[model samples]
Target: MNTHKKQGFWHRFFFSLDHKDIGFQYMLTIFVMVAIGGFFAYVFRMHLAFPDMKVPLFGLVTNKDYNMLITNHGLIMMMWLALGMLLAVAGNFLIPIMIGTDDMAFPKLNKISYWFFLISVILMIASFFMPKGGLGGGWTLYPPLSTGDFGYNTPYKGFADRFFTANTFVLLAIVFEFTSLLMGGINFFVTTLNKRAKGMSLFKMPVVVWMINIASVLFMFSVGPLVAGTFMLLLDINVGTGFYDAYRGGDPLLWEHLFWFFGHPEVYVILLPPLGILAEIISNNSRKPLFGYKFIIKMTLLAGILSMMVWAHHQFVAGINPKAATVFSILTIIISLPFAGIILAYIATLWYGKIRFTLPMKWALGAITLFTLLGGFTGLHLGASVFDIYAHDTSFVVAHFHYTLFPTVIFGTYAAMYFWFNKFTGRHLNKTLGNIHFWLTFIFFNGFAFPLFLLGLAGQHRRIADYRQFEFLMQDPLPLYRHIATISAVILILTQFIFIFNFFWSLKKGKRVESNNPWDSNTLEWQTSSPPPHGNFETYPVVHHGPYEYNMPGKDKDFTPQNEA
Candidate 1:
């Protein structure tokens, strides 16, 4: 029962089997990948901003280089940074403590997952150094365009000197990352189901735990087809198989169907955790119990189920039968209902309560507002098959998704970081710096994204290296909009340094928290020490109330801990 050990660096870090250690490792890895992905974004934004000007570190980004940057940026942020941080980092770190367990059901598997993920990151970074540059087929990796002849071939001399093409490296990196996540998903499912403390019934768990479980199930089920499809793509590229090659009777649309089948649900997989995080933050800061807890759970379930059926909506303009498109459009819109309920439930949680405008709360509230507006945009425009026909592959679609994802993944993660930093690092972040980071981020994020909507409305297509090439985009106002957005993006990227400094600086020099429950919250995580020890609880906690028990009329304290006897 004594889980603590005298450990060396590698034992504690690289090979640690403890869930907390693995979770920390996952977070660190996510930070590194996010920087790399952000660099790619900066490079591409520069290309878009000044088409003729050579970039500093990376000189003139060719069309191929631009494509690779876009592809990798999307893939890394979505797969490695967002998914890894939310599920691998948050899920591993929080689930065991919240569920009153010492560790994940399979600790060794958790370590292995992180290692596989690290390997994936290595391969992805190595791809950039390849003579031909990295993959250029975009993150979707659609066929024909993604095939070996079209995607892997490089004009550079000695491209064949490498054992694997850059495109192959990209696919391999994905395969490794997917494999890592699949293992993590299994761990989440098994641990959450079997490891709860006594009196912790299914309904007694926090909404975040439930959301993680649901997202895990969705990921496990949806990713199989894409895994299979990726392997087929590798074969078509390297081994000369024609699974997606049209001239050999294979169909390119088959890849789209398979990819989006996983891709659409994948968005929800990244989304649900943030929603769950927001739920925790919003309720705790508002001094209220989560409104419509059961309702939110049921709606989240429905949303996950409906997510599978709506994949075809992404293919509306890809020449599917008109009736099929109609069916998909309707299903896509219908999926919005559960999300609407969840959003409303959050709003209800904040209704007329003693709302604390803490840094975390501000982020949670911002995420809700941003997600609602973006979600509304999707419902109003993109959900309609007819409107999607015109909006397909435009900057509008890009802006819409960034709105959903940036708020959910990035803002939600920030909220969790602020809310939980004391628990994780045993120190409070510099509040003034935190507020500065949040406000600047909020202003610049909107400044950067809102103009993409305008450009898309002006018929500006996505993935083009030079917008000036198109006569429509070259028109006075459209070009000017891009310039404004580019400036906003640069400022937005620069503002992140404030957050980075605050995070690391606080780890050593910030104010030390005097109590474990610094937020005065009710979750089981607060029952243990700040940065809880190796066997999380000295005595395993026994749950009494549900996670969100706040403002109980009879209780003297405003919040009620689940483990209170």
Candidate 2:
């Protein structure tokens, strides 16, 4: 592989793995994925808000198509938008930089991982254009519904038995993507363990690196079961296996167990990095050391340990035995204790500090508040066996994930984008436009998802296209709730323009930056030029202090870089 600089668009931008190039590509791919996923969200929301209302803009769609939309939307948002973008993009960009590595252990392999990811994305996009349409099963691709024949008798149908072919492609693509993620994880973990410049110790590494390292460990181990399960499903579809076939004495429940075991871990995998980024942004902008930094790291470890044990909580209502449910429920609540500690630590850091309400800080703070409340409260409902009976699989369930995911993961990605844009481009983003983007998202996000909690509480089942047909909900239908949600959805879609505008506008015309440590960060990445040249540090950076040595009594400035005095 050539280590020398190149000057072409595809060579430099599309097919490069100089961590910076890979990071930007991951961001761009996921951004496009988010847009596609958001469009699906809009369509699904429209159907839910007005169960029988014909969508004026999407007249080609029908009720069966709507159900398919719901399934595809969930899959795209979870895997494509959240995981693909957050971990792949943000992880690629920040990991080496945070740990003070010049580049990944193997840059060419990094490039290979990204190219495979791009291929995976292309395959997923091709699913939508499949002859029978696309894979219609929810992201989980639960059997019976997912594997059954495609016809009117089924709840949702858009194409032919093309689900088998389309979903097969989706699965293959996902396998490649996960392979890339695993490779990246291995690189990150090894780099952190072996390559921290000259004197940076593990304990001295930033909390962001710690969080990401933990997440990478979780991904390495947790993803295996899902890969096994997906292969089983693929075989059951194509090669004629009885792994999940009940009539042949094969248990479908086994697949569920395998899927959720990996599935739930997948959520944490998507979440922790954003929180890591949030910690970095908040600590830097607020000009204070992260409170209870060690405690937060311990909590992340706890979250990972508990993540594997609570997969059955997702199966509580599926007849997994009351005693087992109770056990899982107790463990589920226990997991939240660590998260509570992390939240408290963040809030404590902000107490009486010199707070800067920049765009990155605004979203970081917003995510901390939103995720803390939602991850804690709804978690209680799911953790207690009694409430689980009522809230499981309802709109409340949907709202709970949306609250945790949209804020922590999605917003964190955007925050990192703003915080690092200048470093990547050597230019500052327009703060005014960024602020507009933040406030609008803050309002519309809650406006759109919060009401689903109420609707779920009122007994609306999830994944159905026509709610009016359900006689139980007729007496007290949630028309007003639906209206507000749909309106906000449309508005939210439009608000993303502020982001698109700010990003491109800043890249081309914003103020040029010369500061190496733009955020005055103590981490090693900040020791280099904005958009650090080819090899990250001109020479090597030797760490001399801990990550957050801020506001010492006799320091020249309030803080000093880890490599500095």
Candidate 3:
């Protein structure tokens, strides 16, 4: 369909269908969104640290601004930052390489997906500049709050009118995004299922490819309900449909059902790729085979299947049928088991192996440890109906998600970036700066999130600017939490400089990576050149063994490329 001919550097560099170009574009977009969304976080944290405080450069960020910032932050980070980069960038970049393919099955389709992704992302970012400001209805955009008024009496017009219009744009952007992702998911799923190199079997593929394939299948099916729900919500708001209108006997709970159906699985879809990166990095750096590799694969599939039945857990407080809530609660706890198996598998992989503390390895190891601890503990809290009652919608809930996902997603992304910087830019990142980046991020990340758990335990609800009304936190929410969180946030923001320095400084001046297999990686990706040319492989590589086959007997070194063995 792309009858366009490739011209010169810019087209080949930025808009080309080469997997590497697409991958870098994905990473570049995510970085841009992070800068924008992260600024909102910085200001949001400033507000938390000093309630109703006047900020420099932007003046006072009122509660309404706070709400809009947080909502947009979640949408941007989750969709644009995490999903956009991991699935679109990493998935598109790595899948063809891992499978030993020259390029995506349909290069033109792949390029279109990236372009549409860019357009959708632009529209999403543009939402903040809307006439009435962006949608302030939380990331979930649950009705009433999302469909009702803006809740604050600003100079803005009626809440319903603004909510309807702002949210319409949001839905439209999401629809475009969904279209792109759906095509991408279908392509990836089919490519993995059918297009392995001459000898690569299902098991011979890299764990990252497996993770992406699973996520693709999950996204393919899971996105439909939300796409449908968005249309219904739009119709209800504009066309006077009763889809979400209680007056027309349509229950708002229906919206919750449809959203969470997509919502719960979307987390795993975002997570699985990074987890795959962790699996690869941890195994390679440790110089050991990934322990329970088969188990991890099985668990990934199980988690995908179990995600569907557990959607109603979000509705526990929404007055879903008590029996349904109970079922969902039980299912939610059970679903954590497969995830537990995954954590144990990661931990087990690290036991008694050669531990290299390289930047990428450090991030991989740190993510596994922190993510497991936070994921396990918070899951325990959320699993029980009794605690869920207290923790629901509280800062505890926020802290749990931040701890569990923040490290995994953000750290995993950095790990992927560091791991592939050579492949992306043909140069290595500065290790010294990278280590500093890691430590500061690790410390401040917890600092920013931990107090939230303590505050939430003391009954601080989420989505509010003023927690001073709660006397329990009155003794010193500012000192114990707000100030500390703000300081941590500032430190966190500064820590990224080490990365910016390393990323750009090294892009031009860093040591050149001579060997394609820098880490002695076992996957087929290592078989290609550093930043492989227009077609991935100079010549088609025939994969000969399973991925992660490190330390096999008679191997020249500790690892052998799947394409070589």
Candidate 4:
């Protein structure tokens, strides 16, 4: 198999089609985007908190700059950080190994997806420097504002020559990014279904494999409408089409429907994989049989299905029909029930078992308890039509989103990284730095997000760039709360540098692994070398047990390897 072949630097990092190498590419890019997105958050938050003060690293945050900051922050984090890590990176890295395959079904296509993603990032960034400036029409990119002024900018006769405006570039980015994910999703689905080793049945698959598949499927199904919507909106900008312009005989609400239709399920597309990671870590660290393995799978499918049905809840206050809102409200609440079952199953998995406080598990515990709990409960408030009307654009909604999303996107990504550090680099990340990173992250994250919840309840609208300007919005504790959130954001963003250092430092100098499976994990990936050979395994494995097998009475060790006969 020519496993000893060496490649040049470009092929190794940038130009290669190897799934592992591609995963590395995705990982590096994801972190870079994180820095960019986090900095944007710091800038906008500073603008919100201290009205006219020029941010230190960044210069003065003009109204336009403020809009651009908040808009791009949401886009980068949600688009780049979340999907880049969970779907593109995780699918490429883990799907082949965990499913007992050497590589994806289409390796070159994997490379193409990443290039598409790279182009998308560049285009979005490029949008900021366009003649009309970036699309700060809010992250949702609603029309009228996004479509531009009512005059020559409306499309056709007024603007037939110029098609590549600010919004147009960003839309192009979205189109490219969607194309990339679609390709990756197809790769994941085909690879898992077609490439499993002999005797590795669907029921015996690792929870993560199922998760990536589900996330991919959800993304595939949901993103189509948004893709169409983006194109329509793009035509509205460049080609003089009025697909979303009211004056041009198009309805803006159509864009909203197309957006959230994908938007709500889009959350689960990034979310479900982390829950899968949590299950794996909890079972390994607690040394217990994962409770309700079958049930969790069933619940996950149910949740995915319900995810599609509840997108309308996002549009309840958008002037949709009351009956439609009521239907959405009902579906939104119903969706929570399946996740309840899943969370209970996790809690039960750890019930009275031997629990280890490893870094991955610590993050998992935080995700399961504090992060998910706060996020989930608050989510219920927004699901109801009545409360949503008030909280729709308040600081409370922002708090709810980060509470839910940051956990899955940020905490979940960290847990996976720490848990698999040995496998990725054949070395352990420094433990001291990991804990410090987690605790400081936990403390400051709460300090930042929790205050917003109080401010939301206090009627603090989220879109305001300056609270000091409005007499009604200038209550005593509200300003105090803004300061608290902003200060914590600075520390939270800085705390990540410690992790970045740990990652690179550990890569070169941390303790090298002598064992194949340091975690004593039951997954097939762990059964291979620390960093597996060119083609994952020396010999393809045949699985006998399910992914999580802990503390069986006859097992020599507490955890049973999946490949063991």
| Candidate 4: tens digits of C-alpha lDDT, residues 1-565 | 4274787888798888778899999888888788888889999998888888889998898988888888889988888889889999888888999988788999989999999999998898888887777668788888766665433343254453355567777888999999999999999999998999888999898888899899999999999999999988877666667777566577889999899989999999988999988888998999998899999999999999999999889887789999989999998999999899998999999998899999999999988876557999999889999999989989999999999998887888899999998997799999999999999999999999999999999888888676565675687877898899999999999999999999999999999997988888899999988787778888899889888889999867898888899
lDDT of each: 0.88, 0.80, 0.81, 0.87
What ranking emerges by TM-score with the best candidate at the front?
4, 1, 2, 3
My TM-score estimates for the predictions, one after another, are: 0.97, 0.95, 0.94, 0.98
Best by TM-score: 4
Candidate 2: residue 332 lDDT (0-100): 88
Worst 10 residues of 1 by lDDT: 150-159
**Residue 90 displacement (Å), model 2:** 1.6
Clash tally for model 2:
1
Instruction: Report the lDDT of model 1 for residue 82.
Output: 83
Off by over 4 Å in 3: 1-9, 148-164
Per-residue lDDT of model 2, residues 123-237, tens digit only = 8888778766677877778875666353212333333343446767777877888898887788778777877777887788888788777888898888999899888876666
Candidate 1 local lDDT, 1-565, one digit each (tens): 5566677877888887888889988888888999999888988987887897798778989888898899889989988988898888889988898899999999888888999999999998988887766777888888777664443333333334433677778888899999999899899989999999999999999999999999999999999999999999877776666787677788899999999999999989999999999999999999999999999999999999999999998898889999999999889888888998999999999998889999999999999898888745565579889999998878999889889999999999999999999997789999999999999899989988899998888998887887676787787898788888888888898899899999889988989999999888888889888878887888888999988888989999999999999
